[model samples]
Target: MPAPVQLYVYDLSNGLAKQLSLQLTGKQIDGIWHTSVVVFGKEIFYGQGISITSPGQSHHGRPLQAIDMGETALDEETFNEYLEEMRQVYTADKYHLLDNNCNSFTNDCMGFLTGGSIPSWIKDLPADFLSTPFGAALRPTIDNMFRGPAQGGSSAPSSAQPLASSLLQSVAQNATGVQGSTSSYLPTPAATPSPPLAASSSIAGPIQICSNTQHFNNLLSTHKAVIAFFTSHTCPPCRIIEPVFERLASEKASAGVAFAKIDLGSAYGGGQIASVYGVRVTPTFLFFMGGKKTHELKGADAGELKAQVDLLTYQAFPPHPHASLPLRATRSISLEPILFTQSVNFEAVRSRLFSFIDLSALSDERKKSIENSITSTIIPYLKNKADEREGKGKGVNTSISSGAVCEAWRIASKDLIDNLQVKDIFPLADLLRLTLLDNPVAQWCSTTAAASGTSPPHAILERVASALRNEQQIPKPVLLTTLRMAANMFTQTVLARTILVTRSNGHHTSLTTLAISCLLHDDSLVRTAAASLVFNMAAFYQAPRMEALRSGRRGEAEEEGDGEWEVELLSAVLEAIKMEESNEDVLHRLVASLAFLLHLSPFYETQLKPMLEVLEARSTLLAKLEGVEGGFTVSKKEARALLEEVGTKLCG
Candidate 1:
């Protein structure tokens, strides 16, 4: 069930800004708004980083008013995961007064929770204040008040007299802008303290604060490598190296290594955590691998610390198999999805499509309606989209609506497939191939699911595949155009990945049926397009394999079925390689597809290599290479090298 969300708005000036802002800045700013999101009985806000407490009980005290902001379908666990991602971007060091603040944080949370934004006045307060003459002049002074030594290159000025004298101090103190404590905008003592740790998961950027033994152990067990920093707030040396520790965490945490900080003096269980690890110093670093301490460094030495971190990460994740390969040409190949983005003559295409329909078996009424839709809606939209893509759009108001295009596609696809001849369907498929290049139309087609009255995502791709499979001999033009359309589906990566690997009503969809069939096509164009589609699929599975290699969790690929997909893709690719004789370009693409599928594959040892041995993949490739005419080109040389590397290194 969805939960109610509210925005807790506070007046950072304690209502004094309202009375004095007109005289001080000559701007009638109502209040210096500080906001927090209230949901699931927790008041979550960003201050010394993100904090969670009982509703209306954060250090800001009770909010002046709580604005109800609808509800969210997202559950707590999913929401927390979103917050974990945000922690990387919204670290304490990144906070700013007018730039990024508590209100901005609440606004972001509100959008995630309710698909809505906070009241504009609350979030726009800073901009409004900054636009004033006096406010503009004081921007640097105000920013310097909160800037720490690491950021400002000097000790932060005392908030006591930040503006030089009493009058300036009073105004500066009242107008501190947003969240963190500049000595002026100190947090009011809360009746109840905020939770010590927002989460135990390994998030990037900020140091992961561990408050208990179990929490610390959980971080260690989950990550392959962890660096625990023992520190205390009272120690000056801890402050000196804290920034270095944070910078390294940001750099290395994404690679699946965890960085934890345990404060020896704290109300939470940080002291207990330090005691368990026998840490008594202010800035001690302990490197743990597989939850066992391997190295330790006391005090701050930035160079040695970085060296140790690099050593630990290297020991943990190591390098991917492809890293050792010397295939220069293949390494330079771009993995971007092949999209058909030509600004084709929509009027000419529409006329050709009408002529094709006229020769088809469609009823007269259906023909008239379809032609009218092509003339009035889809053509205009495609034209506008083309103009926009070429930076020729006259203005925003002249743009055509995408909703009309989606509806027209539904009607045209149904009518054309149901009534037109298989050979004549190329025009319609060609039109859709062009239409799918438009981002709005592609996004809509990617996400729309089959419902009581709606068509499934990529229905046209499936329809085209069905024609190829059911017909005795599909038309070459139709097959080529359809294959191009299938390749274009990778424009939306999630849509292509999800739809291709999935079964609909218990049968193979276009991926296993259409792409696999066209893989060994007699026509090089059709086969090249099919190889592109297959490369997209291979790249999808290859991503998790790479992540698994980086994080020292190679077993995860098997558990998640990534290995199964690689084996299935490779079997078809190997068959294609055996039959493919000439065309270096097609062979190069096929070899690159193999690289994505076979490199770092978890099934390499158990399933993939055994299959390769049975098929004699190396001998087949060598035989193909032996037939080259004069000499090997750079592409063919790299292609053979890639194939050889796979056969010897991976399969051996």
Candidate 2:
């Protein structure tokens, strides 16, 4: 038995409190919390609830946000059963046609679909969708009966409340503004709807389940084990454990262990279910026997998950007590090799993606052919191009605008991001393993301190070094691009070691570095990159050559941001700057860097006088430029601030 199940939900949208309590109290029970609240870590849009309280017991809550999965602690296994049942209900006796109540008449009465916004495909329905034979059949419940022969879905929703108002609300609310945030906004589907049930009237326990608190109080008197498998479709661990839970559901339903699963959308818009549950990571299993949760499993793998489930299943669940796991700080191994290989498996992924595009809707065979051609050739072509731009190709110029280049990057992008997950790669496997063991900040808030994107620059450098040492011959373009990207990405202190290995006097001959130094590039971004690289020069052979350039003792053909001012060759760099004290922007930023250099060596007396003179000159020039107020604001403020700080320190 594990420790008593304890969850710390940060947001408590009380929408599903009732349904939640009931499903948890009974064995084989399930609940769908229609939390209007946003989601977290992932999406939380599963709106129906279900449970298997005792044979005679039952529970109910608000009209489901979507499907009305019956009462039970919903798990992957039982959820599938619910879908099958809904499908059967949809396929079976047309409730409107049944003699129960409808006269095929005024039943067109206003029906509120109430939850998610309707899907776009709804507009494609036939004109008579409301009054036609299909309409007449489904009019009583949903309206136009087109989806199937009967059940309420095929029918057109009545005119009083059009389909537009109700069907797709969930989908639209979570939509993203950019392709960047798209996956983060996707709604995670829970266990698929179960196979159809025999009849609405044939179930032993109450089929309709809800999260109402009142119903919850009444459910505790029955059943043995009620386990809530709070999960999400976006979670990697959840996928791993879903089948395991499914098997558990099948083997233990009659044995008295109940299951429930909730999609915690806390990571998205801060969905209430996740907020209330305080779910951060996935595969959180909360087990309850009688009315209270007895034990829980946090971060369970295959073996641990089975063990946890077994511990909670039979005799009253146990309470596990243990010290915190030890933390490890070193992150040496990587998961990149594995993930990249998988991303290149374009054929398989492409096939699966297109399988969802309904072919029946594609009318023109020519159009279909075009679609196939694009997917088969164009996409792959563009992807290869993007890889080349990213330095994945030999002897290719760095090009960001190539459509093929973007497409290839997207290929890597899609493979890495399978839903809310970044697939497991061996290179990252140990890195994540160790980073997580020691750094909580990196673990919980990855974007802040943890680096992840196409690839971290350090990781790329490491990959390059590894290949050179063992694999095929190292490509110069790959090495050069990696260095440029490294300078652009990490702080000097962070990438210092890697910078040493690849840079040398020969780097001047490297087209990659020369390309980066072009005057046409954005001055601000490129300047910052160049400075950062200069600050960390411990990697190359003949380090003093760089130091001599920096000191003005040796002058190279220098590239400036705007235009270069010609100067005679000098032995040290201070002389070059002194000789061209003409450009304001150049002087301002150099003065800015002086403070940094002073950090290493004190700016005492004799040296301070020259620095002060330049600072005063720049300040006067900038003040003249600032006469128009905000016109030259960046330079104006920067120059004045630079002088003020230097003067203060000198005086101090």
Candidate 3:
């Protein structure tokens, strides 16, 4: 049976409350109203406090209206889980009077339950009032008044008179622009929503059961890789592999592997589909890629299934370099802001940034121009480009705008490096880093060709790379930040290919050379970041190369100098592993990168023995050094399993 939903609305006062508040408090109270969702006959309310109040008790002599919102198909467990997630996002501490308040919570719940939002008039009341001239002028005072405490305390307004007056005062304050933190008022730049859930077959845990042949084929076609477990209701062996398959699916979902089960005895076309696939036995497993069968197995061997799935998962999407790394630092690293949608401590970061550079040579006007360009033009251009890529905005011409922004930054960067005797390079690199942090604008700028059919974006990156390579006195933080930004560029396949294949003056660009140089840097963090870059570049290149090879388009012909670079990268990683001291993060990245490079490269056999030897040595030492006061800390069992798994794959 579908679960019932009810929308309960309570007006704090009649029409007279608004006029009284304006005359007494000198502010317009749009309306003092509260809304809640009642599911399964429980009256749930969210405000300064969340409570399940008795249905009639919540009205408090005020006018009340209840609307039947139909029913929801969600099971109790799924609904509870979703509610928990909603609780995290709608935390009471983060609530604001005008922005994310009781109404916002109600709208979210209503949408989730009924697939429709509340009426727009009530939703837009606060925003509409704040747009007026008087509303604009009174906002600060209003925000300050309500910022004192959240409403609905244990010492609540008991009588209808006090409750109505207090609620009216609260709404008036909200109308005048009284709110929470400063970040609440600042408009978050809009971006396109992600593609609909149906477009991607990326699953998070759980083995999905396909209902019919069409369903099975659709999942296979949309997903990069799919593993189908064919079973029958009466087959006992199928039960053995059920739990194992679920566990493996959960572990590998993040790596882009999808798992499904088909009961051949079902009334759907499962029997016919199994016969077509030549599944003569129960508990048969079939692996598919690009709608073609790649591997098949009979019976229910959990170990073999795990190994095959693990191999296929890595082959599809390489593991994140830090996936297995155990945290060693007491505090986590602060993430850089997405300037478009996030609030940043601009003044603090800028003050620290200025101390690193000597601006005496450049006039105050020029310095201000540089700062203004970054704050006003460059940030917005990048933000817009990011939004456009995600299928958001009015389809702006980002290629031209982003190119201009990159050109401006390139000029500013060169000027600073030449004119200013930079006291510390870290701050400057950090500033540049923040601009491109996870925003693919840098890569797009580099790869997108100009009207002359010449790449201007490459020139910008080349300048940054040249500075890193030639400036021997550059601080470690500066070098690290520069390399991180460079790594981010390789996230785009075209940019990665350009970096790996492009050459200047009979040599690879300094950017590539700098990455290689950092592979053996004395600092562990630098080494890990560099290794991650190499892994990303190799993974991006391998996917298409492998596909081309499978299609017989690129037959066994390795790109020029590819082997040499792979060997150099592998050697550097092995040496880093041997030299690493108590840095689990470095060890994890090096191992993960090595696994990717080995599997993807043609030289796996040649490098296998030495790689295993290094791992064995490290594992032995790690065993003894485990839990020894910050000495080589890691999940020993996971480390051992990784080594064993890699060894088995190599030996086979």
Candidate 4:
């Protein structure tokens, strides 16, 4: 059977409450009175905070009106839990004279118990009382008189609280027409205060008490995983789970999984945090990883709580088998040249490329000179060099060389960079794009060895990279084009090695970070380009390493940074797949990259399972794309098959 709910309202006076409002604020008002919700014959009330009192004794006089709020579907346990949550929010310290007084509490109670709020006229009374010029001017004095220390007591109820109480009691006694007895309804103070909740012992591991939202968020960010226990001092279930919570904290301390208990009864703003998470019960547990809430459990079931804590701890601190693996297995793989099969339209590209260049940014004669230098001089020079190299019976070198074409590239790059403005950057990028379309120059730049002791061909490409990095206000087209050029340079084995294998100042400027940064770019085209670049790098270089790690020679040097670079790359790919705007091509490439990275990497499988689970849950999308054709260069059906195959391998 549904629980019965009733709304009981009391009149402040026959009509004196209205007269007082008119005198103080020069505005007529309805009678002010106290209100409460009676649930299942028990008067469940929230004043400064939540309380329970006898039903018939609540109103000093007969209520002005008793409205049936209808029955509630909530069971006794659910109702009590909701009340406990309300107690946290309506704590004594949080009450205000005009903003969050008893009326507000009553409104909340009504909404929860009956799925309806009290009338707006009753709810907005306090605000109406304070809105007048005279009322506003007298507020400070009235506030001080009522809010100062209570006579013979250290604390005082705000003016609104006492005013409501005094008027209700006085009028109840004098008004002959009222129905009930005029007895005081104020709760008798307890003779002995309840003992403070025992603090969880440090021997069982320290349980941090988060006092505010910022503190809780900071803890989440600092720890790899966190278990937040929301407890209340007055709740029996919360107390019952305390010891078990502490025990698990102690057991998992060494694993770097943080344990925290929030006293919703005592901690300031604790209720606000609970509200943010939609927690409406004591002994609620929240599990967070990487600043996201991954799991939640409610109730005081110790066995279930312990099991969840164990699972979270295990995931937070997984065993590292890579520690025992060979250095050869973990080391980066060798780089290789990426050959393009698509036919190029050189004249069409050159024409469109020059059209976007900002001639106004350059002197007219200088612009003409620059155009002649790249097209008339640089292009012809590169073509001639490529022909000469081919005539000499030399195939492409394994390393980039600082030759005539390389020198000419450097000069042309410098000219573009010196005069380049935001508008001109796209044209310059397009120029680089056109240069790569010339197969001979592309092959020469990609494979030739650096002229002894000089900068490699890849180094010339850095001029463009540097310009993009340094210029903060670059247009999206320019940035996309620049990234494309860098990606194009990486197709060369030597350049790929330079970017991926070689460290600059002990830090790898990873293609993973670069590609991930652009994944969120406002322009879809930019995101597509970034996704394509990531796929190319991962497919060519990183994929083979995973395969070799599964079946190749072993070596030493077991100690290294936890594969953060690999994790970052994998995370980026997964994130791109999850994005709402990720097109079929982007998803295809991203999944392919993920498949390559997961191959034979047992450690990654454990770390990546959560994200993979998210993808698996979206089975509809996977099924839809299973036979749909279109990818970086393959059909969606092929990409889906590859993903499933890798997923099976990882599972095994």
Q: Candidate 4: where are CA atoms >4 Å away?
A: 1-369, 381-402, 434-476, 505-510, 520-525, 543-551, 556-562, 580-582, 601-636, 647-652
The total of clashing pairs for model 2 equals: 93
Which residue segments of model 2 deviate by more than 4 Å?
1-221, 266-274, 317-652
Ranking by lDDT: 1, 4, 3, 2
Candidate with best lDDT: 1
Q: How close is candidate 2 to the true structure, as a TM-score?
A: 0.19
Residue range 356-463, candidate 2, lDDT tens digits: 232324435533553454365434553554465467773233332334432333333232222211111222222222222112212121121112212232333344
lDDT tens per residue, model 1, 1-652: 9899988888866665664454334345677778888888888887655667788766666789988888889899887876775564455554555545676567667756776677878765654564432343344455565443222122212211221233334433433323333543343355222233333233222245554565466557656788888888689988788788877865565324678877776543566777777887878999999999999999988888889988988788666556466644444546566665666666777777788899888889888888877777777777777777889865343545777788887777666765666677777777777777866676556435312112323555556667667765787777777777767766654345235433342113565577788889888888888887777766655554543444342223322234566677788888897777666777777877887766756566677778888877777666665664553433556676766665565545
TM-score of 1: 0.61
Compared with the true structure, model 4 gives a TM-score of: 0.37
User: What lDDT would each prediction earn against the true structure?
Assistant: 0.63, 0.30, 0.51, 0.52
- Give candidate 3's whole-model lDDT: 0.51
lDDT of 4 by residue, 286-389 (tens): 99877789999999999999888777765765543443443331233233323322323445645654664444466666666656656655555434444455
lDDT of 3 by residue, 1-652 (tens): 7898877766544444453333222234545566777786666555433445555444232226777778887766665565554453344333445544566666666655666665665555554444322232233333344343212111211111232335445454332222333223322112111111221122212354553454455456545678888888689998777778866754443212457777776543456578778887889999987678889988889999988887676566544233333322201211111122222355555566555433447777777776666656555555554565567773343544645676667555645555544334444555554455433444433333211111333443454466656765555766676666556654333334344544432114555666667777888778767766665655544443343233221111232235656666666666666566666666655555555565545445454445556555345334433444445555655554454444345322
